[model samples]
Target: MQYNYNISRITLNDDSHQLIGEILFPTINNDIVLLEHVFINPTFEQQGFGSLLVAEFVKHAIHQKLTVKLLDPFAKLEFAKHPEYQQLLINE
Candidate 1:
């Protein structure tokens, strides 16, 4: 299935304008974004929304030239499989 999600620091809403998921990348300074949390509605879990959020975050990080410090376990597993995305993560 294909899903188009808006990667925003604010929120991600569905067609009805209700929030279905969100990926939080809070900035600590100018060169890093911390992937603090990823939330998907229970009804939406296991449908790949989490993966999509991580993908979007990687894209955003590329654009902003930011390194990601991931806090979520799900995001870690998602990144582990994608070597390209793994490069964007902070080693420490």
Candidate 2:
């Protein structure tokens, strides 16, 4: 089997495409965009793809002027190590 992976923004009603991974942010009244979940297909984990996906999401959040609120800090710590992500860190 072969797998191709990419990052995409998906809503609850939209499921036409197969998702290798996803980061979900629930709608709420706040300046912070909560990263509710981050998932990668097992076949794709630990190969740097997760970080790339996170970086993409971070870019999206920053563009919307929302701070990223990571619910699972440990899941994101790997991606946060990249220097470009320093500004997005929320003090815990």
Judged by whole-model lDDT over C-alpha atoms, candidate 2 comes out at: 0.58
Question: Model 1, residue 2: what's the lDDT?
Answer: 31
Candidate 2 C-alpha RMSD relative to the actual structure: 5.9
Error of 2 at 44 (Å): 1.7
Q: After the best TM-score superposition of candidate 2, give how far the Cα of residue 45 lies from its true spot, in angstroms.
A: 1.9
Residue lDDT tens for model 1, 2-92: 3343443635566776666778778876788788888888877888777877787788788878888888888888888999997887777
Give candidate 1's whole-model lDDT: 0.76
Q: Which stretches of model 1 miss by more than 4 angstroms?
A: 1-10
For all predicted structures, in order, the TM-scores are 0.82, 0.63
The worst-scoring run of ten residues by lDDT in candidate 1 lies at 1-10
In model 2, what are the clashing residue pairs, if there are any? none
lDDT values, one for every candidate: 0.76, 0.58
